[model samples]
Target chain A: MTAALEARGLRREFGHVRALDGADFDIEPGEVVALIGDNGAGKSTLVKALSGSLAIDSGELYSDGKRVTIDSPAAARALGIETVYQDLALAPHLDPVQNMYLGREVMRSGLLGKLGFMDHAEMKEKTQRAFADLGATVRDFTAPVGAMSGGQRQQIAVARAAAWASRVIFLDEPTAALGVVQTRNVLDLIRRVRDRGIAVVLISHSMPHVIEVADRIQVLRLGRRVATYDAKQTSMEELVGAMTGAISQEEAA
Target chain B: MTTATEPDRDAAAVDEEKPKSTLQRLVGAQAFQILGVLLILIVLFSIAEPDAFLSINNFRNVVVNVSILAIIGVGMTFVIITGGIDLSVGSVLVFSGVVAAKTMEALGGQGVGVSIVGALAACGSGTLWGLFNGVVVARLKVPPLIVTLGTLGMALGAAQILTGGIDLRGAPTVLTDTIGFGRLFGQIPYLSLIALAVIVIGAVILHRTRFGRYTYAVGSNDEAARRVGVRADRHLILVYTLAGFCAGLAGILNLAFFSSTTIAGQSNTALNVIAGVVIGGTSLFGGIGTIAGTVIGLFIPAVLQNGFVIMGVQPFWQQVVVGAFLIAAVYVDQVRRAAASRGASTRRSLFSRFSRPQGARRKEAQ
Candidate 1:
C-alpha cells in the first residue's frame, strides 16, 4: 500500500543547531505510527515541518505518492492534514463547538451566509455527533474550553483534528497531561480514527504507550531517524537504546 | 477499572441533562445583572425627584444627549472584545466632524445634497484614520494602546491644524434641523433613532456573524487562532478599522447635534466610552463582551449625572461614582476570570463550593 504521508531528507536548522538532519519518515494508510525521540531529538520540528506550521531548510514531502508543498497550516489542511500541537491550540474563551469550527464555520444559507452569519444549530449538532462518535465526555457545551478540565480539553483538541482530517492527523504528546483513564480514552479514539482508514502519527516520550497503540515505531536521535521497528517485535530496552544512541541501526547493519 | 469509570461517566451524562435553575441562569447572565443595576438607579432617581427626574421630557433629554456616546460605545465594545483599545476614537471623531463641517461649508448649501456629502466626508476621514491605526497595530506589531495614544494626539493635532484651533460651526441647516432635532411622530429624536439602529445592527453582527466569532477567537488566543488557519492579523486590523468607522459615524452625529466640530469637547469621550464598555461586562483582557451590556453601562453614568443634578447633589459627583464603578466592574471580571481558569463554574459565587486542591485534581493513571 502507498504511504499516506512520506518525507525524505528533511533538514531544519536554527543557527548552530540542526533540529532535523536528513530525517526520513513514512506511514502506511490507516496505520498508527509513533514517532519517538529524546529531548531536542527533532520530534516537534519534524511534526511542524510536515504539518505546514514551520518551514524546513530542505525536504521533500509526498502525499499519496504525489509531491506537495504545505507552506501554511491552511495549505496542510487543504491537503487533508491536521495537527494537535502540544499546546492544544484552542481559544480558551470559545466553547467546544466554536473551537471545533473556528476558522471553518458552517454558515447559514442564502443571504445570511453571504453576510457571514454562522448556522449555530447545525454547528452544534455536528459537534455533538463528533464528540459522541469519539466517546469524548465534554459536558456543558456552553462553557469555554479553557474552563474545562485538562482531559476534556485534550479530547476536544483531538476530536477537532479527527473530525476535519480526512487523510492524516499528527498528535504531539497528546496524552502527556492526561490521566490514566483519559489516556485510555485517547488511545481508543486513535484506534477508531485508524479504523476509519486515516493515517495517525503520534509523537510521544512514553515507551509503554508507544508500544501499546503504535503498529510501527520510528526512533530519532540527534535529529536523524536512527531505527524503525515493528512495535510488537521490538523490546523497550532496544527502543530506549536506539533513542539514547547505544543502538544505531546503521552500525548494526 | 471499567466499573470504576462507569459511575463517573453516568454522573457526567446526568449533569449534562440537568436543567439550569432560574437563579443560576440569571447569575450567568452579565447583561441582565447590569440591566437590573440600571433599573434600580432609575427607580432611585425617580423617587428622589418625582416631578423632575420621573418626567418623560427629562428621560428624552437624557437619551438624546447619550445617543452620540452610545453610537461610539458600539465600536468600543468590538475593540475591547478583541483585547484592544482605541484611544484615538475621540480624536478621530473630532477630526471627522471638522472635515465634514468644512465640506458642508465649502459646498455652500443647506440642502440635503450638502448633508449627504458632509456625512460621507466624515465617514471617509474616519475610515482612513481607522485603517491607519489598524495597519500599525496589526501589521507593524505595535501595542494597540500606544499606537492609538499616538494617533489620538496626531489626529486631534491634524484637526487643529485644519481649523487653526477654532471649532468649525455651520453644519448645514438641513443636517442640524432634520437629523439633529427632528422627532419621529413628535416623540423620539432622530439622533436617538439613528443610534438605536446602529446599536441593533452592531449587536446582530457581534452576536450572530462569523466576523464576531473571529473577533472573540483572536482575542482569546492569537496564536491558537492563527494555528487553526484564522487570519488573525487581518481580523485585528478589521476590528480596529470598524472602531474607527464607528467613531467617524459618531463624528457626523456629533456635528449634527452640536452644530459645530466640538474639537475640544471630546477629550474625555474615549475614557468615558471605555468605562461604559467595561461596566457593561466587556473584559479588557478581551474575548468577552456585548453591545447590550455597553448600552446599559453607558446609561449608568448618564443616569447618575442626570439623577444627581435633579437630586441637588453636585453632578461632578457622577465622575467619582463612574470611576468607582469602572474599577468595581474590572475587579469582578478579574475574580470571574480567576475562577474560570481554575476550572470552576462561574454560575455560582466563588466561595459557594469548596474546590479541590490543585495537586489533587490530577489523578494518576492506573
Candidate 2:
C-alpha cells in the first residue's frame, strides 16, 4: 500500500544550526507512528517541514506516493494534513464552535452568505457532532475555550484535527500538560482517529504512550532518523538508547 | 482501545439545567449593566428637572447630538475588538469632511447630485486613510497606538494644508435638508436615523458574520488564527480600513449637521469614542466586546452632559463623571479577567449559584 505521507532527505538550517539534516520519514495509511527524540533532535523540524510551516532547504515530500510540494500551512491542509502544535493553536477567547470553524466558517445560504454572514446553527451542530464522535466532553458550548480545562482544550485541538484531516494528523506532545484522566482521553482519541483510516503522527517524550498508541516508532537523533522499530516489539530502554545516540541499529547489525 | 465513556453524569445534568430565562441572560450581559447606569442617570436628572430633563425634546436633542459620535463609535468598537486603537479618527473625520465639502463646492450645485458626489468624496477619503492605517499597522507591524497617533498628526496637518487652516463650509442644501435634519414622521432627526442604521448594520456584521468572527479570533490569538489559515495581516488591515471608512461617513454626517468641515472641532473625538467603547465593555486587551456595549458606553457621557446642563450642574462635570465611568468599566473588566484566568465563573458570586452547576464544581475540585 502507498504510504500516506513520506519525506526524503529533508534539510533545514537556522543560521549555524542545521535543524533538519537529511531526515527521512514514512507513515502508512491508518497507522499511528510515534516520532521520538531528545531535545533538538529535529523531530519538530521534520514535522514542520512536512506540515509546511517551515521551509526545507532540500527535501522531497510524497502524499499517497505522489510527489508534492507544501510551501504553506494552507497547502498542507489542501493535501489533507493537519498539525496540533504544542501551543494547541486555539483562540482562547472564542468558544469551541468558533475556534473549530475559525478560518473555514460555514456560510449561510443565498444572499446572506454572499454578504459574509455565517450560519452559526450549522457550524454549531457540526461541531457538536464532531465532539460527540470523538467522545470529548465540552461542558459549555457558549463559554470561551480559554475558560476550559487543559484536557478539554487538548481534546478540542485533537478533535479539530480529526474533523478536518483526511490523510494524516500530526500531534506534538498532545498530553504534555494533561493530567492522568486527560492523558487517557487523548490516547483514546488518537486510537479513534486512527480507526477512521487517517494516519497519525504522534511526537511525544513518553515512551509508554508511544508504545501504547503507536504501531511503529521512528527515533530521531542529531537531525536524522536513526532507528525504526515495531512498537509492540520494542523496549523502552532500547528506544531511549536510540534517542540518546547510545545505540545504533546499523552498528548492531 | 476502550470505547469512549460518557462524560460525568453530574456535569451533564448540570449543563442541561442551565437557566434559559431572558431575565437571567440579560442580567449577565455587560451592556445591560451599563444601560442600568444610564437609566439611573436619566431618572436622577428627571427627578431633578421634571419640566426640562424629562421632556421628549431634550431626549431628541441628546440623541441627535450624539449621532455623529455614535457612527464613529461603531468603527472604534471594531478596531478595539481587533486588539488595536485608531487615534486618527478625529483627524480623519476632519480630512474627509474637508474633501467632501470641497467636492460639493466645486460641483457648485445644491441639487441631490452634488450631495451624492460629496458623500462619496467623504467616504472615499476616509477609506484611503483607513487603508493607509491598515497597511502600516498590519504590514509593518507597528504598534497600533503609535501608528494611529502618527496618522492623527499627519491627517490633521494634511487637512490644514489642503484648506489653509480654515474650515470648509457649504454642504449641499439638499443634503443638509434631508440627511442632516429630515426626520421620519417629523419626530426622529434624520441624523439619528442614519446613525441608527449604521449602528444596526455594524452590530449585525460584528455579531453574525465571518468577518466579525475573524476579528475576534485575530484579537484573541493572532498566531492561532494564522495557523488555522486566516490571513491575519489582511484581516487587521481590513479592520483598520473599516474604522477609517466609518470616520469618513461620520465626516459627511458632520458636514450635513454642522454645514461646515468643523476642522478645529473634534479634538476630543477619538478619545471620547475610545473611552465610550471601553466604558461599554470592550476590552483594551481585545477578543471581547459588543456594539451594544459601545452604544451604551457612548450614551453614558452624552446623557450625563445633557442631564447636567438641565440640572444646573456645570456641564464640565460630565467629563469628570465619564472619566470615572471609564476607569470603573476597565477595573471591572480586569477583575472579571482575573476570575476567568483562575477558572472561576465570570458571573458574579450572587449569580454563580444559578450559573455554575455541581458538575463544574466537582471538576474544579479535581
Candidate 3:
C-alpha cells in the first residue's frame, strides 16, 4: 500500500547548520511511526517540514504516491495534516469544548448558525465523546485548560488533532513534560488514534515509549535517517546503537 | 474488595473535591461581588437622597447620560478582549460625529430620512478608520497601542481640519430632538434605548456566536488560533472594525444628543470606556470577560457620578473612586487566577499521591 505521507531528500539549514539534511521518512495508513533521534537529530525539523511549519530548501513530499507542496501551515492542514506541537498551543483560558472546537467550530444548521452562531451542544458532545473514546477523563469540562494538569491538557491537544485530522497527525514530544501516568495515557491515546485508521507520527526522546507504542521506528542521526526497525523485531540495544551511531545496519542484522 | 477504610477514603475524596468546585465557582461569585457593590451604592444613595436619587426621571437621566460611554464601551470590550487597546476610540467617535454632521449638512438636513443617511455615513466613517487601524496593526505587525495612538491623532486632526477646529452645528432636528429626546412607546429615551439594544447585541455576539468564540480564542492565544487554521489576522481586523463601528454608533448618538459634532479634547473618553470594561471583570490580559460584567463596570461610575452630584460631593471624586475600582477589579482577578492555578497544582499532586502505592508500588511505578 502506498504510504500516507512520504518525504525524500528533505533539506533545511539554519545559517550553517543543516537542521534537516537529506532526510527521508514515510508513514503508511493505520501506522504509528515513532520518529526518534538524539538532541540535534533533525526529528523536529522533519516534522515541521511535513507539517508546513518550516520552509524546506530542498525536498519532495508525496501524499499517497502523489507529490504535493505544503507552503504554509494552513496549506498542510488543507492537505489533512494536523500537528500537536510540544507546547500544545492551546488557549489557556478556554474550556475543553472551546479548545477542541477552537478554529473549526461547528455552526448551527439554521439561520442563526448560518449567521455564525455556534452549535455549542454539538461541539461539547463531540469533545466529550472523543475523550470517552480515548478513555481519558477531563475532570471539569468547563475549567480553563491552564487550570488542567499536564496530562489532561496533553490529552485535549491530542484529542483536538484527532477530531480534525483525516490523514496524518504529528505529535511533537507529546509526553516530554508529562508524568508517568500521564505519559501512559498519552501513549494509549496514540495507539487508539492509530486504530482509528489515521496515521500518527510520534516524535519522542524516550526509547521505551518509542518501542512501547510505535509499530515502526525510524532513527535520525545528525539530520539523516540512519535506520528503520519493526517494533516486534528490533531490540533496544540495536535501536540505541542506531540513534548514537555506535552500530551500523550490517552489524544490527 | 472494599476495605474497612473504603468509606472513609471515599469521604476523603469528597473532601478533596471541595476546593476544585470553589475554583470553578469563582466566576459566578465574582460577578455577584460586583453586583453587590452596585446594589450597596444604589441603596446608600437612595437612602441619602430619597426624593432625588429614587426618582424615575433622575434614573432615566443617568441612563441616558451613560448611553454614549456605554456605546463606546461595547467596541472597547471587543478590542480589549482580543488583548488589544484602541486608544483611538474617542478620536474615532468625534471623527464619525463630524462626518455625520457634514454629511447631513451637504445632503440638506431637513427630514428624519436625511438624518438616517447621515447616521449611516457616521458608521461607515468610523468603520473605515477602524479598518485602517486594523490593517496597520495586523498586516504591518505593529503593536495595537501604537497603531491606535497614531490613528487617534490622525482622526482627531482630520476632524479638526474638516470643521476648522470648531464643533459642527446645525444637525437635522430629527436627529437632535426626535430620536435624541423622544421616548420609545412614550417611556424609554430613544438614545438610551439604542444603547441598550447595542449592549444586547454585543452580549449575544460576544457570548453566543462563533465570532465571539474566535474573539476569546484569539485573545487567549492568537498563535494557537492561527495554528488551528483560524485566519487570526483577518479576525483582528474584523475586531478592530467592530470596535470602530461601535465608536461610529456612539458618535451618531453624540451628534443627536448634543446637537453637534461636540469635538474637543476627548482624551478622557477612551480611558473611561477601557476602565469600565476592565472594571466589569474583563481581564486586561484578555481571554476572560463577559458583557454583563462590562455593563456593571460602566454603571458603577455612572451611579457614583449621579449620586455624588446629588449628595453635594465634588465631580473629581468620581474619577478618583472609579480609578480605585479599576485597580481593585484587576487585583481581584489576579488573586482569583493565582488561586485557580494553585488549585490545579494541588489537584495534580493529590492525584499522583493517591495513585502511588504504599512503598513498593512507588518504587516500581515509573
Which candidate has the highest TM-score of all?
1
* Clashes by residue pair, model 3: none
Which of candidates 2 and 3 is the stronger one according to lDDT? 2
True contacts kept of each: 0.60, 0.53, 0.52
Please give the clash total of every predicted structure, in order.
Answer: 0, 0, 0
- Per-residue alpha-carbon lDDT of candidate 1 for residues A20-47, written as tens digits (9 for 90 to 100): 9999999988999999989999999999
Worst 10 residues of 3 chain A by lDDT: A244-253
Give the DockQ (2 decimals) of all models. 0.52, 0.45, 0.44
lDDT of residue B167 for candidate 3:
93
lDDT of 1 by residue, B1-366 (tens): 445464354323333443346677566656677788899999988887989999899999899978999989998898899999989999999999999988988989799999999999999898889899989999999999999999999999999999999998878888988889899899989999999999999999999999999999998998999888789999988888888999999999999989989999999999999999999999999998999999999999999999999998988999999999898788778877886676544323333324644434223211
Put the candidates in DockQ order, highest first.
Answer: 1, 2, 3
Q: Could you tell me which 10 consecutive residues in candidate 1 chain A have the lowest summed lDDT? A: A177-186
lDDT string for model 2 (A90-147, tens) is 9988999999998999998999999999989999999999999888867567777776
Q: Looking at candidate 3, what is the lDDT of residue A44? A: 84
Q: Against the hidden true structure, what lDDT does model 1 obtain?
A: 0.88
Query: Which candidate has the top score in DockQ?
Result: 1
Please list the residue runs of candidate 1 whose C-alpha ends up more than 4 Å from where it truly belongs after superposition: A250-253, B1-26, B347-366
